[model samples]
Target: MELTRIGEAAGQRQTPEDLRRREDSKAANNMVTPQEAKERGITWRVAPPEPQVCQFCGQPIQPQGIVLQNMVFLWRPNVRCTCEKAVAYWQEYDRKQAEEKARKEDEERRRAMQSRIDRLLGNSGIKKRFQQRTFPNFRTDTPGRQKNYRVAKEYADNFAYHKAKGDGLYIEGTNGTGKTHLAAAIALQLISEGIPVICKTSSDLLLDVKKAFDNEGVTEAQVLDAYKKVDLLIIDDLGKEQCSDWSMSTLYSILNDRYEDMKPTIVTTNYNTDGLINALTPKGFDNTKIVAIISRLRETSTVMTMAWEDCRGK
Candidate 1:
């Protein structure tokens, strides 16, 4: 009984302390000691390997060379190059190539646009003989001629705005003035700038319509539509044609359609507005139709008086 009591007292005091010590000892054993590592040939410190060579030029890479790893390019990447000179050469080459490509594209576009302008002007029925007439070449010698020339030039220069605002011109005056010359000059200038234009004398247009009625495969609609749809229609010599019922009616239809559509037109006449009205309203046609046509002209057209004496030497 005495031995059992003594052992129980010792056991109670030592049990917790000994259990903690045993746990600490087990943790210490789990750690890798230096001696054990050496015996196992495990290295804790090592020197890094040498840097990679330049894959591009097979040259030695500089310490501060640009380095990109695992990169993808259009032609096989993961490429590293330290050749600054070669890289610069290729960059310049690519830049020049891009510039050349852009230049060619621009040139091609310009040529195509010019070709389209040429075709439109050719098909516009502007007399080939008058193609050379231009505002620059029109005579500005005398005071009166110079005045008319300046106005015509201004009109030509500002034609883009005139077309946009649906404005037109009624260039009328005495016989010797260069009305037709200025009108043709304006037409050619606008045409050169890619504006669609048609030029025809009043008599010629009426003659065309008459020919269309008599000729097979030619229709009045075709002849009239050509005049109606152009961007600019030049009707030269307004009262030249005889005022028969058919002539007046055809003229009215052309003018009325253009007026309703707000299309711009250039009209040249040897008579003033009143004179033109008188010439058109002869025996027994409709005076209202003549009034209507003249009214639209007065409303939309800028009246330009070319008072210059006839430039052509009599």
Candidate 2:
């Protein structure tokens, strides 16, 4: 007769060989007590097997985990274990928890960045007309359009360096040749990079100044300072409106402020130099101020002419 351990359950006698094998497994991981095993109608040993019971179902004890303490257990599947269902469930639960945490963190970061972008764009004074235009949507069907697009993209990509070096651009083309589109693309790209850019048409800028004059509550200096202080200033449709004594003077002040400070400015226009001069100094007005403005623009700007016909029809 095989002798049972102290407090062994008084049922299901096991052979000496069988008892020895079971004892080895229990000693390695389980926290079994003879009295407890006897009450449960199971084998008696020094300890229970790892994960003695399925944590989820609390059914069928198995040698699936290691017993680190009297009752505490850690899952460590062994060859003799029959607790596959319980092990798989906990593994999947932990995995899903990790994934959900990561997703939430990513979403939070994205929303924070979008909020910052919105604030910067709001302060930029970019018009609603060109808000949707970007470099990818810019048409490059013609060779000239392609070259112009490439140059504009290069300028945008290296905006920090170009701005630091006091370089600017003069984009001249007929209406509908994508000059405004390209300029807007550059402004949007810089804005996305956390740089502030002001985009407005010459006519609108003059109207803003005029409104300041009419409204004594707003000062002209405050209005003008915004244009001069931005990282980039885009004057779209330059020379499109007839320059007035007040308009020309305001334009000179804004341009000269940037010129003296070495800030970058991009001017989009339909007129060549001669046409621009004609437009600027209409009715035999003294061309000296206009000449001075043009001189400063030419000195710091790389003139890019988009010769393609208007693509608005296409």
lDDT of 1 by residue, 150-209 (tens): 877877889868877778888888886788889999888876776667788888878777
Residues 100-148, model 2: lDDT tens digits: 9987885675455445333433345567777888999987778888998
Using TM-score as the measure, which candidate wins?
2
After superposition, which runs of candidate 1 have C-alpha atoms over 4 Å from their true positions?
1-125
Q: After superposition, how far is residue 190 of candidate 1 from its true place, in Å?
A: 1.6
Q: Which candidate is the best by lDDT?
A: 2
* lDDT for each candidate structure: 0.72, 0.75
lDDT of model 1 at position 63 = 23
